[model samples]
Target: MNANMRAAAPTEVLRYTAFSADPDGGNPAGVVLDASALDDAARLAVAAEVGYSETAFLTPAPQGTEGAPEGRAFTTRYFSPLAEVAFCGHATIATAVALGERIGPGELLFLTPAGPIPVTVVGGDGESGPRATLSSVEPHSEPVEDKDLTEALAALGWARGDLDPEIPPRIAFGGNDHLVLAVTSRERLGALDYDFERLKELMLRLGLTTLQLVWRESAGVFHVRDPFPVGGVREDPATGAAAAAFGGYARELGIVPEESRFTLHQGEDMGRPGELTVDLRAGDPRVHVSGTAARIG
Candidate 1:
């Protein structure tokens, strides 16, 4: 270990659940408000200790960095138990709400490895607590290769005929890459059994963070689940990043109107139900994901 790693100061890690008002409903995330004294190794250690799917570490941004106003801009990094990811939606929302409690709700800028993310927090003092809306970077989707899709289905123990033909398989990118797969029935979606090692290998090989397993309930309502073996977690209760990527995928594929809003209900199968709201504007390519978070002891 290096000198900095050895002498790392203890930091306070705040626990909060994102995408739901109830702490027990959403995805739990660890937030390190000030990670200035910790190095990369120390940060990862904290995340592993917290044992959530992901954690957010915030350090002060460099002076005069664009879009980073004083006292509100931060260079944030997301780390899973196994590795550092480019971006994490739930952690970002959790961190924003945590900051909102301390600094009041409004706009905050986070410089992430993926890109600059703009987050807005509102109604912190209300009965529901703070709700955060994160505007993702420009998003795009592309068709997945035949071989890769076949391999994914096999690892998932799903047949090709089980897929929803309306939404073709595609790799979508908002903050990170997720393979979007829409199923024909909610029963298929709930029966979450997969070969963890095999799926993790495929995800790591394809630079995928999670597989966005979804079942469309209506034109604007959907039930979603994410298999996140790559993050050392079998499933992510509520995945903000995947939700944002799915929004882009829906818009790009014309599954929904150019300007539309949709609801994604996740974590129900895990007994931790959470709701995510995704909005797409007519002229804007970026997707907006909004949800409420609550502090967890």
Candidate 2:
């Protein structure tokens, strides 16, 4: 792996979690610290080899000083195994913690393709180690088209009667756009079965990043499972992108307090459990998603 990453053409994958401390928890991501040297094909190849849901690529800031820039900032781009993604929150968290390891815990300013994302890394060493929290870009939500909503439900093998009317469907954007669909029951959320190719096709046509399937467990808590066929994944355990989108969706619909902190549990059915904390500011539209990520290996 070192040879692959440092042999004139450097591209190595460093594993880290996105939303939890335990390696078994959180969303896993691959990080390539020096992607500045690689071309698009090389970078994509490296990501495909690394095999995480997504990988973060770091390049010299288009406009900034070298050697970690001001406030540990750098330009970043994210890519899945198959294609490039505009932004990825889980990968942002993973890369922040990875940077923290090399430079010691502190704040990292990630100049993402979507926008500038600031991440703070705190805690680390032996039994106790570093964890990261990322504040997302400004979030916003819009009403879901009735016809589109019905199509989405049919795609997921769900019924209109099974939806939570209060949360109202919406297409929300935090970093990337996500379709927020709230199921009336946890059982409906858990019994996920969809034609992968069909969903992928539909998502591509709609320019969607993922499908946020959720069930509100309480006023300030929710359970989520994301169908990411768009990214060639069946289900995502913990999705920081969707969490941010969901936060915006909830607030836009007056379902939760304007400034509130909430919990999201995902991946229980798949058995790789993860917990994500979503924080909304009183006047800010950007939702902050917090979690601790450990090395997958």
Question: Highest TM-score, which number?
Answer: 1
- Candidate RMSDs in order: 2.6, 3.4
Off by over 4 Å in 1: 1-8
Q: Kindly list the per-residue Cα lDDT of model 1 for residues 1-297, writing each as its tens digit.
A: 666566535689999999999989989999999999888999899999999999999998888988776799999999999999999999999999999899988899999999999999998556779999999999998999999999999999999999999989999998999999999999999998999999999999999999999999999999999999998999999999999999999988899899999999999999999999999998988899999999997
C-alpha local distance difference test of each model: 0.94, 0.83
CA lDDT for candidate 1? 0.94
**Model 2 segments beyond 4 Å from truth?**
1-10, 63-71, 124-128
> Candidate 2 vs. truth: CA RMSD?
3.4
| Per-residue lDDT of candidate 2, residues 184-240 (tens digit) | 998888889998887787789778999988899898788999988877678877888
